[model samples]
Target: ENGEFKPAYNDTIKDYNTILEMFDRILNPDPMSYTSPELKSVFSKFKDLFEKHYEEQKELENSYQVQSNTSTQAIKAKLS
Candidate 1:
């Protein structure tokens, strides 16, 4: 069932968020450093990249779900 896929997808999202947070911390280091426009620019770029990849992943997941549903319907139709 589709419900079974949710837990795994949620876990993946949690892990991805954690990793991004860790990277942000590593890149920014301190609040004072965040005051620097250069540091802010770099971190912003990193964040943009993270969001791009996250969106791509979500699109891929949606495509897979559509394919799965279509296949399941086909199988059910064949059975009945």
Candidate 2:
């Protein structure tokens, strides 16, 4: 729980849940029947951006994990 924000580890799940909610809203036509075309377009854009952000964050997390594991193994080797 450092001050640094880790999107991959911390925000990914929350963001994904939010995305799921967005998807549900988009797919359920009953509630959105009255929504304007402009608003729907905006929602579509938002969903795309969220997906891109999620992918970037996940990649960053994977890179960090790989680096961390490599460092740990090096430390262990040095100690041995």
Candidate 3:
């Protein structure tokens, strides 16, 4: 329950987008001079993990879209 950043693998797309936006703010704070080296290092790790999750989810969505479109086209062809 710690407010630590972790990948929300099963979360909906909207939730994932919200987490990404928050993480972006955390990784790039307005006053960059105030962040400690250790904190920065930790945030960097979070960024890497989050980026991987984002990419994986993006690929899945793209494949699903392709499949949906193909199915729709096949249905249309059969109907016509």
Measured against the true structure, the TM-scores of the candidates, in listed sequence, are: 0.58, 0.69, 0.57
Per-residue lDDT, model 3, residue 49, is 92
Q: Which candidate number maximizes lDDT?
A: 3
lDDT of 3 at 55: 93
CA lDDT, every model vs. true structure:
0.76, 0.75, 0.78
Best by TM-score: 2
- lDDT by residue (tens digit), candidate 3, 1-80: 59887754555665666777766666666674366678878988987898898899999999999999999999999999
> Which tens-of-lDDT digit does each residue in 1-80 have in candidate 2?
77977543345455577766756566454653666678778787777887899899999999999999999999999999
lDDT of 1 by residue, 1-80 (tens): 85555422345446777767766765666655444668667777888898899999999999999999999999999999
* Candidates ranked, most accurate by lDDT first: 3, 1, 2
For candidate 2, the per-residue lDDT at 79 reads 100
Instruction: Show where candidate 1 strays beyond 4 Å.
Output: 1-34
Model 2: colliding residue pairs: none
